[model samples]
Target: MGKLTIVAHIKAKADKIDLVKSELLKLINTTRAESGCINYNLHQDNSNPAHFLFYENWESRSLWQTHMNNKHLEDYMKATEGAVDEFVLNEMAEIDS
Candidate 1:
């Protein structure tokens, strides 16, 4: 019922970095426009070009789940099927001060 933070780490296959990065980039604008999306940011590892991370915050878990089932997300999964080598996702709740 509270805010949700998501940390998603995606590592592209050595030969598919560009493809993966581009596909990942496609999610930003669309995701940012989604309801309940507070922020959707993407980051690439400085030393590892093939590594990517998405830092996201949503108003609620329900909304975030809606985002996960979106068409664009499905497309991204299809587009980057074999291009990614590793994927990890973490969902957390911010500690109140």
Candidate 2:
């Protein structure tokens, strides 16, 4: 099976972005050190400072599932529960790229 791509589009209060982004960066670094993580990244939208994106890749869907159950990931989510106004998660298949 191919890698699983997870795109987390997060939009929080204008002032909360720094907090959210910092938390996401920790998650990304932790994820990258996991057993099956291929890559993990956090990015901010140039036009919308309050908007952020988390791009993560796992070796397999099972690995991704494992990541969801990871303590760090759970802790991160719990810490930022209501800090966001909009949280959109998207799973993607890399057709050609």
Candidate 3:
């Protein structure tokens, strides 16, 4: 199977940007340590402080699925409830060169 690439766009509620940022930051270390993780990076938009993005690469779709069901991720979802205004997650595969 091919590697899985994920692009996640997250928007924080105006009043809750700090809270959302903190929660998202907490995922970095843990996610990087997960099995089959190739890379997990987080970014903030220069033009919009409330806008955030994550770029993640995993060995396979099954590993990515494990990441989605991780306990820490579940806690993050609960903690960010209502603090996040929008979230879009996209999964992709690299095209052979």
Candidate 4:
């Protein structure tokens, strides 16, 4: 298996933006410390405060999967249950030139 790149977009409910952003921020430190995590960065849209993006790179898809199943992720889900309006995730392989 090769490196995996994940692009995740999260849009918070208008009224729940703060809550969702906090919960999403909580994932950073822990996720960055996880094995095989090369990088995990969070971004908020300049014009849209409720929009968030997570740009991540992992050593492998399996390790990324492991990270997905971690307790913190589950906690994040529980914490932001109804706070999110839209979520999209994309997994890709870097094209080598």
Per-residue lDDT over 36-78 for candidate 4, one digit per residue giving the tens place of the 0 to 100 score = 9999999999999999999999999999999999999999999
- Measured on C-alpha atoms, candidate 4 has an lDDT of 0.97
lDDT tens digits by residue: candidate 1, 41-92? 9999999999999999999999999999999999999999999999999998
Instruction: State the local distance difference test value for candidate 1.
Output: 0.98
C-alpha positional error of residue 24 in candidate 3 after TM-score superposition, expressed in Å: 0.5
lDDT of 4 at 40: 100
Writing each residue's lDDT as its tens digit, candidate 3 over 22-96 gives 999999999999999999999999999999999999999999999899999999999999899899999998898
- Model 1 steric clash total: 0
- Per-candidate TM equals 0.97, 0.90, 0.96, 0.97
Per-residue alpha-carbon lDDT of candidate 2 for residues 2-61, written as tens digits (9 for 90 to 100): 888999899988878888888887886677889998888888999998899888888898
Candidate 4 contains a number of clashing pairs equal to: 0
Q: Which pairs clash (backbone N, Cα, C closer than 3 Å) in model 1?
A: none
Model 4 weakest lDDT span, ten residues long: 88-97
Output the better candidate (1/3) by lDDT: 1
Per-prediction tally of clashes? 0, 0, 0, 0
Write out the backbone clash pairs for model 4: none
The segments of candidate 2 whose C-alpha lies over 4 angstroms from its true place after superposition are none
> What residue runs in model 1 are displaced by over 4 Å at the alpha carbon?
none
Give the Å shift of residue 90 in candidate 3: 0.5
